[model samples]
Target: MLTYTPAVQHAQPPASERPWLLLLLAFVWLWPGVFAHDLWAPMEPQLLTVIEQWRNGGHWALPTLFDRPYWEAAPVYVWLGAASQAVFSPWLLDAYEAVRLVNVGLMAIGFCCIGGAARQFLGRRFGRTAVLVLIGCPGLLMPAHLMSTIPLLFTGAAMCFYGLSLAKARVIMASLMLGGGWVLLALSGSLLLSLSLMLLGACLPLSPHWRYRRYYLVLPTALLWAWPQMLLWPYALYQADTAAFFSWWQQQALMPFGGFGQIQFDFSLWYYLKNLLWFAFPAWPLAIWSASRLRLADSDWGILGMAWLALLGFLLAVSPLQFQDLLVILLPPLAVFGAAKLDALRRGAAAFLNWFGIMTFGLLALFLWLGFAAMNYGWPLKLAERAVYFSPYYQTDVDYFPILVACVFTPLWLWAITRQHVRGRQAVTNWAAGITLSWSLLLTLFLPWLDAAKSQRPVVQQMQKAFDADAVRRLQAGQECVSVEAGNHTARIAWQQYGWLTLDVDNPHCRYRLVRRSPQATTPAAGWQELWAGARPREKREWLALWQRLPAKPTEPAKTLQ
Candidate 1:
């Protein structure tokens, strides 16, 4: 018989060495980018638009964008965002910033749940190690701080994993967690993903490592708790608005299976596989090393992690891939597996990772600082010129506060790497700290420039200026509604929110029309005089144009007199 010993059976560390302080610092590092910038284009603005619709007396059960029901996902994140805005907008925060606070809370929950799961499986210290592994991932950085449902999805997965970890010992608690996690997954808006996870839960007993009788409680508890909670939202939505509910149901039912017919199967399969190279980063290599040290049937945690990873990887391979979706679902199991046997990692591999992190982040920090200097002081004329080339409208303004913060972060990172003994866990810790430092530098030292490139506020302002000039010429006062044609959700949201312009895209009576097009594209249907044309400073191929309808040239007076 092959004997298996759990890592938790090893000797415990002293209380002083607990990771509370490090976890706290990691969380603090996550705070800067969340609140320090304007809502960026593409995703953030789209989410904000939905929350705005909810807050502006739209149906609470249905998240709408531009007064139409948006069923791309469930309304859980939107509901939280709306609540956050309502709570914080009254006092000190902008609506967008307030809404983003949800990301922070969700991320914290995810970290804690992952840590808890890791502790149950590996040991106390490995819990912290797992969290650090997750924190160190390059892929987790952006999604963890974004205002989206991704964090919710991540937290839900973590909760389920933690529940699975508890199944051998704490059956009732595990049942609760499994049930709650299933509901959370459902709420995060992918029914297929939620059901896949549920299927994993069901098959837990089939694994030789998880054949405990208590494991049977998981599926029953999930059915009792999760099924009803999952149905509750749809039922409530149905009662509130039947049409909106049907739209949501149709989308939920069709989205996963429907897109397969259109997608390139080969490309879709390779997408996540290739992205895993950079996305999971250091964690994936560590996970591979950790997996090599264990047998599949030896540890329950191993079986669970491997099964979860396989299931999620398969899902990503077959489905249309979004980086956020892949990152949130895959990172937890990767983190757990990565940290499972760090102490057993070969010395050469640990040292390589240690030095690699130091060298990589050190060079990246140096480059970022150089760019910062170039943008502010014109020290490197070439870099300065390149910066201007990227964002021509960006003005160089030196804010000493961010500079001071960057300076502190750099020295602190150096101190951390130098002070740590180059063991496996310590190496991972250094990597996590380096990631935090680099992200901090980007958010702080480079935020203004990045905001200049990414934010649509400037574009909206330029349009406002043009609209004002038009108003002056026409002797018209007050804000006029603009009809948008072929414009994206980002532009529409930015214009309406920042410019305070009423948008009625369907109203033919509106005199002003805003259109988005390629730079080379001709005017959209003539009879309209161009009033404004502009794009974001960093946008190269596409631009927005405002057009005013010309009055019908007085109808030529009916062919004159006899």
Candidate 2:
């Protein structure tokens, strides 16, 4: 509570009380992205394993990625997807949509949290401004849609923001909200972030009237709310792993700099400045100006915003994987200051922003349209050749339904922009609408080609067809020795979902086994028959082959892949 001088005058009006319109708008903008493409490879399969574990009543804490125990982080983030999946599987919605919808919901709540925080100290108008900042920001496009840890972690950050904002009017509410939010933030693979937030709340400046509720009044209440974190994470950590587990665990979530294998920072100021130039977009400039203008004011709002922005910078500089994990946390806090900055802007600069949005997204949309045309019609031979070069398996078939849908959308977006040109709120509206329009075009126009190029589902299905019939029949007849792809997360998931194998019911060795690697990679051990081989045509690096045990063969054939 850094109430060094007095509260900022901008917050005289209450924080945003009405949040529905923004939520609805965000939904309309974001909903399609959730369903556009299949769960991507490399990461989603690993996350899905945890949800599968939770659904199957496995070790709740030690979620396995294939069949081996995976200890990247506790399964705190997976719990949401698991619960949603359990409630709506093979019934009301699809397995994928169920979890994706949960992510969208979290992102929506994050908007509200950011909006609420802005409203608390910056006034009601600024609350909406904060939302526009997030809505218009570039960093959130993919993370907001996917069923990854980032969306939930970001939502938890927003909740903490809201709780922190509630301090002046409702002490009890602030305490509970802040405490619960911190617990979730920590549980969602952000232990250090939670600790810092907890410390921030403890040190926040309070008005003279609000001083009585500072330590003696708020600490106990906050602790009660925060204490559940102990029951949830620390206790589970010990119970789930022995001393041996720490080796793999250290490489993952337990590491201070949380990268997959090692910590690597892109420490160049120019690198972040480049990211800020576009990633934070209009908001980054606004936040900077706000900081400059508010530098001398020791108001709680100014102090808090600077602190949060500074912390985001620190995290980006320090995190093992910069720009990826921390962007969601960065957007909301910056949005509050951004909102203030946007409000203070003159009409000319605002109009310039509107034009920038128009031309930028307009050109990008034109490029996508051109690409879509080249894919379907091949009039532009060079463009088509380039597309095919990247995605060799891409088959171009023009679907009229989406084309018609996009045709209808194009006019509507144009009309909306024309109206915004006449209206007072030009900057954020134009920016957000442009981004949405461009995004929608991509989703509607190019999604099928992307799926064809990227979806591992087809490859998985083909592998299922090649599964040795004799081995499968033996399994059905209660025989042993089913194949396992030891420590191979993708192969394990592909086989389990599309073939008859699981980590739980079988061991690693058997008559049949799976290996996922490049063609030049190692073959299976002695006495194995190469039955089938396949690779993602778009990505040559992803290669897989099946091997069958041939213990009784008179002579062992040289190791080979089909």
* Model 1 vs truth, CA RMSD: 5.1
lDDT of 2 by residue, 1-562 (tens): 7668876675323322445645555766777666646666555666776777667876666666544666553467677778888888759767777777777888888887888888887776777778777878777877777667777677877887887677776778777777777777767653667777766665654433224555346656877768776356655755776642354435554334643445555564455656777777767877776777675246666766666767766766665554454556777667887777665576677777778888898898788888998888885899988877766666776778778867876776676568533322456776887787777778788888777766677777676677567756766676745555455667667656555545333455566666666777556667777777876665557688877777784777888988
- Ten contiguous residues with the weakest lDDT in model 1: 258-267
Mark the 10 consecutive residues where model 2 has the least summed lDDT: 10-19
Clashing pairs in 2: 1-203, 1-204, 1-205, 2-204, 2-205, 3-205, 15-119
Q: lDDT (CA) for every model shown?
A: 0.78, 0.68
Predicted candidate 1 versus true structure: per-residue lDDT over 1-562, tens digit per residue? 9999767664434333746758665765678777667788557888888887788887767777776777663588888888888888959888878888888988888888898999999887888889889888888778778776778888888988988888878878898887888888777655666788888977867877777677876668657877888887778789888976666666553345432223232236666777788888778998988878887558888888888988877777666434535556888888988998887777687789899999999999998999999988897999999998887767787789988989888888898789534678878888888888889999888899888888887788778788566674542443456777534666667766777565666567778888877877766667888888889875668888888888887655567678
In model 2, the runs with Cα more than 4 Å from the true position are 1-24, 205-216, 240-274, 377-379, 395-405, 420-424, 462-484, 499-513, 519-533, 538-542, 546-562
Score candidate 1 by TM-score against the native. 0.91
| Candidate 1 local distance difference test against the native | 0.78
| Model 2: residue 541 alpha-carbon error in angstroms | 4.1
Q: Estimate each model's TM-score.
A: 0.91, 0.81
Q: Please tell me which predicted candidate would have the highest lDDT against the true structure.
A: 1
| Cα displacement (Å) at residue 30, model 2 | 2.7
